[model samples]
Target: MDREQHVHTIDTPKARIQAPAFACDSHIHIYDRRFAASPGNGAHIVDRATVEDYRRVQERTGTQRTVIVTPRPYGTDNCVTVDAIRQLGIDNARGVAVLRPDVSDTELDMLDRGGIRGIRFTLYTPHQAVVTFDMVEPLARRIAELGWHVQLHWTADQIVEHEALLTRLPCKMVFDHLARLPPPVGTSHPAYGVVRRLAASGRVWVKLSGAYLDSQVGLAGGYADLAETTRAWAALLPQRTVWGSDWPHVTETHKPDTAAIFDLLGTWVEDEAARKRILVDNPAELYGFAR
Candidate 1:
């Protein structure tokens, strides 16, 4: 396939806003045209989202720093994400990567030098690329040796079932998308209880991004409930929680409005002091973002 000939037209929502100076889009993905190549072999072929694509969105959204997460379509490849960090420069970027059990220490050190601070395990996809409990222990130990965290993308149910193995890890754990919790609009959900316990562990951090993925209220109503749930989680462990935009809303029928997404974050951290902590202080400390 001709990579240059296939230009992706991104239909971003038209909500405008002044970008916040200290604000960071904590979660994003970048696909390179060369390495990740065509979205062939059962991979979903979306337009290549390069560092340049992200820079454009950051300019419009006023996002100062970003966390480039390794996406599923790319499988365990970290080349695209690593290149993005190098091109964007470390002062403005960090990354989460995927790895196989056999990944060498030398390779991990190289990634660390390239601005990768975390590793991710996807537990919710049909791809079934879920990391086993056995994999978590040793992998967590290695990541701990590198001073990085493990980002878990599991459904709320899995989180509950895997509590023992997850908490046993030596490294820090970051739960993506409100820990993939069930929408708070329902009955006594196990996810909420699990999240509460995980937050109390002091080693776990949750990203208040991707609420749109779990909410039933589309964008408007969905975000409100998400904000409320996030607020509750933050209250449990204000210092351990952070915010992210989950930009580019890949594979979704309705893309999220980036501007409004940031605005909604304000609702999650209502108190002025707490808002500063979650949006600025906490993320800076967790990801080692340069001041």
Candidate 2:
């Protein structure tokens, strides 16, 4: 079988939903321990999981393109993320890095040529993070000229407190894990309104991934607790949402069922064209992937 046409899944009955042509997993992490982890950033170390492993995930998920996020374990050292983009073929992969605000323009140019499309700050689980929240604006200003975005994984309350800072950043913003909103009051959360206002400005993209992240009801119910927030985002920002598997799931003690998580899109949007918007079109536009 031709490599690009390859389709495989980890499920016993096999995943019935295949991703559309050019569909992209807009967030993932590739860990290569051959490159040493930065000091105090070792909690996320998963042994030897590289691009080859992720390609199998792509096969399982039926996705052709992906965006590699610099995992928290690597801190500001983007080498692992950069190398994954090269290995996965830059045309089919892009990266979101973690960088210090003092990163030189030389290094910045190097990253741009290296297929990096954005930067991420993992404030949700902050511990020895090299970049602080205060550094966001300056770095946001720097990357804005490069057309790169600032991706955030802040908690809902953090979003509420940082409203002034969140609303005025110079570049585009991509929030992770359904904006980390708490359940039951999912869309009604104050942070959701802040995000909605931000989205209304046409500069925000939210990952329709990580259904298990904030679900009080847990995955056995197919993350039904997330349904309200998922549908609300789909209704409001179909053009701005993208999907991710959070592959390897280093943060979780139990791995999520990837096929089942991907299947959540079916629940989120029954309309296939809208699903394609999250799976294909929006990512191609956000990450500069060729359609």
Query: What lDDT would each prediction earn against the true structure?
Result: 0.75, 0.84
Model 2 gets an lDDT of 0.84
Tens digit per residue, CA lDDT, model 2, 147-171: 9999999999989989999888978
Cα RMSDs, all models:
4.2, 3.8
What range of 10 consecutive residues in model 2 has the weakest lDDT sum?
A: 1-10
The residue pairs found clashing in candidate 1 are none
How well is each residue in 1-291 modelled by candidate 1, as lDDT tens digits? 321222233554432544446776789888776675324425653663677766766655677888999877777778888888889888888999988678998999999999999999877763556355457678888889788999988888888888788767888899898887666652256867776676665788889888888887776474665666777778877888888877667755666656677777665665777867776778888899965
Best by TM-score: 2
lDDT (C-alpha) at residue 59 in model 2: 63
Score every model by TM-score. Answer: 0.87, 0.93
- Model 1 reaches what TM-score against the true structure? 0.87
